[model samples]
Target: MKMNHGFSWQYDEFKQVGTDYGSKAEVEIYDSSHADFRDMEAESIRILDSLEIKRSNVLIDFGSGTGTFAIQAARRCARVYAVDVSRAMIDRAEAKAIKAGTSNIEFHHAGFLTYEHNDSPVDAVVTTFAFHHLPDFWKGIALKRVNSMLKPGGQLYIHDVILEETNAVENIAALIDKLATAGGKLLREDTERHFRDEYSTYDWVMDGLLSRSGFTIKSKHIEGGVLGTYICTKN
Candidate 1:
């Protein structure tokens, strides 16, 4: 699909905010920082298992940071597209994939609103902690684009920080405190930056966005009243 250049309200996702993942230093520290809260390798395995990935399947991973999921998925799927907005991230992921001897993965320096999937419709698309980079409207547009990239009944898995409406203030505070305890000052500061600068939205809004984007929400799981995982199928 051609990019819209005319007058529109779409947000430019490439604009850096608090943390610039494009920086080599940031990319280098990403895995270590996230390791405080995430077991990325195990997470990749779980996502692949959830999707029931096969040797013949083609998968696309949006914002595939440091090649964790993309490299792992490449082992099981026929081809894997690792798309991210950061050139540094793409470079790092590519290096990691090479070190692992996984060559079926193609790396793209692109974002959700900009990446074009020109290949055949994929079997599944996965994005973790990345979709929130876009505003709600752009997220809908991105989801529509994702829907167009999938085969019939294809799956889209999104894991991100989505807020719950009930006691939002309390929940967010508790989550911040918990993260601080688990990951120390850096994570606490990161979480604060996310809330202060990022665009994570509410569950109700996300539900509507997914439905309007021609997706059937198969399951929704929210952990610690903040982290949301939505398993959806293209309608």
Candidate 2:
């Protein structure tokens, strides 16, 4: 994938947002810290199965942290293009892919607004916990770009921190408390920083973005009013 230079007013997706994934130290402890809350392997398997990924399909994974989901997807698919903005994260992910002996996965140090997919349209595009880096306007633009990268009726799976309009504040606090209980101080502070600084928007806004950007939402699920998952198909 090539990197596209946008207009001067365009959002700088490569810039470090709320979380400094550019830090090598942060990259090192990412999996361990997230493991306390998320089962990456199991989540990857579940998502792959839900998407009906096949041996002959090609897919793109945006914000492919540490290559966990990319490696798992490569095992079941023909090829996986794993992309990230942070060079540190990409380095770690590439190293993990090599260690796992997965050669079908390609690592690209790019982000939502800059990554230019030149190959034939892919079967699916998956992004997890990364879309919030972009503000809502740029998010809509990014989704349009993602739509162009996919084949007709291609799938898109997005999992991120999204909020419900009602009880948004209380839900976020409860979610933070839950993370703190599960992963201690590190998780608590992390969650706080995410909501405090990131661009997580209401569910209605996300739905509007997807729909107006050329997708039909197949399924939308929100857990505990903080995490959102959407399975959509290109229209």
Candidate 3:
């Protein structure tokens, strides 16, 4: 699909705030820093299992980060597309793929709103901790593009920080305090910056966006009143 030239209100996802992941040094430290809280490998396997991915299936992981999930997915699927907005992240993920001897994974330096898939429609799309980069409207557009890239009944798994509307202020405050206790002052500051600067929206908003973008929510889980995981299928 061709992007519209006349559209002028698009968001630039590459221009990051709170953290600059474009630097090689930052990319190098990403895994270690996130490892304290995220067991990404286990999470990847869980997603694959949930999707019932077959050896013949093709998968695309948006915001592939350091390629941990992409490398693992490549081992189980026919092909894996690892897409990220940062060139540094793409380079690091490619190196990790090489080290792991996984050759079926293709790396692309792009984000949710910009990445275009020209090959056959994929079987599944997986994105974790990344969708909040876009504001709500662009997120809807991104979801439409993702839907276009998938065959009918294709699965999409999204894991990110999504807030609940009920007592949202208290929930966010409690989450920040909990994170601070678990990971120290750095995590505290990061959580503060995330709320202050990021685009994570309420659960109701996300539900509306997903439904409007032609996805049927098969399952949804919310953890710690903050993190939300939605397993959806293209309708």
Candidate 4:
């Protein structure tokens, strides 16, 4: 699918829907259906081990969907910044944080790519399943922003879909599984619509982002082998 620079979804609309997707969507996608997106797909095991949270370290979950990850990070991380573009998402994240009884978390309802933060003291910038939404040109720009947010020598532990470099068929079961889950209906439709709308040229549910972006590709933790965690080091 070819991505159009101006063919981005209405930011507000997309985010509002995304915010409502709490643990239910995340857990279901990973557990019962879409085996590729299974909880293991988030690369939690690898992320947990690769994470270097400490007494004084600070971490940020860029585009934190519903705070599930933020809550988990707060347990071990001294502090965590959960930033998302949707106000709804931020509210849910904050609510989740409160429910989880985590005090070290700071929630921001702003686009991480454009949000301003002067204190770039974080040890690592953890971005999971967010970068792919960026407009064509901004993918690189977004990476630079995340890179800048990291302290010198900090790490970037990202876990997102690693699109195949070649054109291969998608699993039909993944499509069927989406129809059975809580938010699967919309997720499945939108996901397919997105691929259909965008994958005509330079991309189309293809994998090339992480590989094309030079960040010193480090370790990748795999689940179904198609989905995995990528841990990178900053120069």
Candidate 5:
């Protein structure tokens, strides 16, 4: 994937922040590890349904980990662009796509800051648990780029660890405790590390970023005060 020739001080997204997804071992265990808590296929179908994806539309999955959503989306859309920062993740996703007999997905080893969409504007852009890879400033910049990649009135869906200002500390503690009970020490530590190192921001900040980047927030949903989902349309 060709990178943008931006300022010299651009953030190096390839150098992962919290989890070392670049490691092949991490990539190998991602699916099983996440399966303990998430029904990825069901969640993907719900997202596709929420977007109202049509058979003729094109969609982009920004953090297409392991091709779960990408393959599912490919079955419903004309084409799917699966983009990720880790080459190992991309390779694993590609292998799974092949195994699933999904041929419409185009895998790209790129992140939000580095991905370049050369084709025509896509119908929608979907990302989950991925946007926090960048700090708030870079997230704003990345949203502007995402805005440029969509058609007029196209949709954008974001699901990530966004917080609420009220009882933020207690909420995070509760979330960590919940993860620990659900997936034991491994997931508990992962959740702790995410909050400590990742750049998850407040819901108000995310709303402002989407609005400033030319998106109209159609719907906003926050679960457990830590997980957030925003469905937006290009302005």
Candidate 6:
């Protein structure tokens, strides 16, 4: 087993590269006519479908990563606020919206756990592969903030990559990912700047956050592996 070297390299050598990878990936899609969001487009569609975002309500995507979720969700939601910590990611997301001629989406560059705005209430808060990178306390605080940010009966869904339910050929799949991304757009950086957040975080913290925040743990959908999607609604 070669291990998830691509993920490991990201966790150990290109800090904040998760945000960077997302931003650059959109650049790839924008520059090439035949460029697709790859499998992510399908994955986003599937996940949002599971979330069931309402067309009459507002939805906010936390750490929205180039607006993949935001864009798909706009069809059903009145507006989609795409929030990200990196300006580069926010910029790419805006570019994609313009290219698509969509007017229902907006981009905001803001940290995941540090967003201070609570004025524009949203009906749902969605995050994927982002919460898995925070420690327990931060995850809890984030859920609390999100819960407080939503309108009554508002929904919150956190999707992540877990280690246990990962597919058997995960290592091989990762190797393929490495080869496919090789030189395509590597986040050239030293170890101190890698995806350290994910390497240092886990999913149980999120589960605990839901419990402690008094969020109604409604459902769990394991999509990619043992690490799947968890739906928790605030009461």
Model 1 misplacement above 4 A:
8-10
In model 6, the runs with Cα more than 4 Å from the true position are 1-38, 165-202, 223-226
Q: Which ten residues in a row have the lowest lDDT in candidate 2?
A: 1-10
For candidate 2, lDDT tens digit of each residue in 40-102?
Answer: 999999999999998999999999978899999999999999999999998998888899999
RMSD (CA, Å), each prediction: 1.2, 1.4, 1.3, 6.4, 1.4, 8.6
Q: On lDDT, who's better, 4 or 6? A: 6
On the 0 to 100 scale, the lDDT of residue 204 in model 5 is 98
Instruction: Name model 5 segments beyond 4 Å from true.
Output: 1-3
**Candidate-wise lDDT, in order:** 0.91, 0.93, 0.89, 0.59, 0.93, 0.63
Q: What's each prediction's clash count?
A: 0, 0, 0, 13, 0, 7
Worst 10 residues of 6 by lDDT: 186-195
**Model 6 Cα lDDT, one tens digit per residue, 90-207:** 7877887888778998777665555665557677888875665555555665677788778777778877654333343573255335434542443222111323334323345556
What TM-score would every model get versus the actual structure?
0.97, 0.97, 0.96, 0.70, 0.98, 0.71
Q: Model 1 clash tally?
A: 0
User: Runs in model 2 with CA error above 4 Å?
Assistant: 1-6
| TM-score, structure 4 vs. true | 0.70
Give a tens-digit lDDT track for model 4, residues 179-216: 44645565576566544543221322222454444355
RMSD of 1: 1.2
Pairs that collide in candidate 6 are 14-193, 14-194, 15-193, 15-194, 55-76, 162-227, 165-226
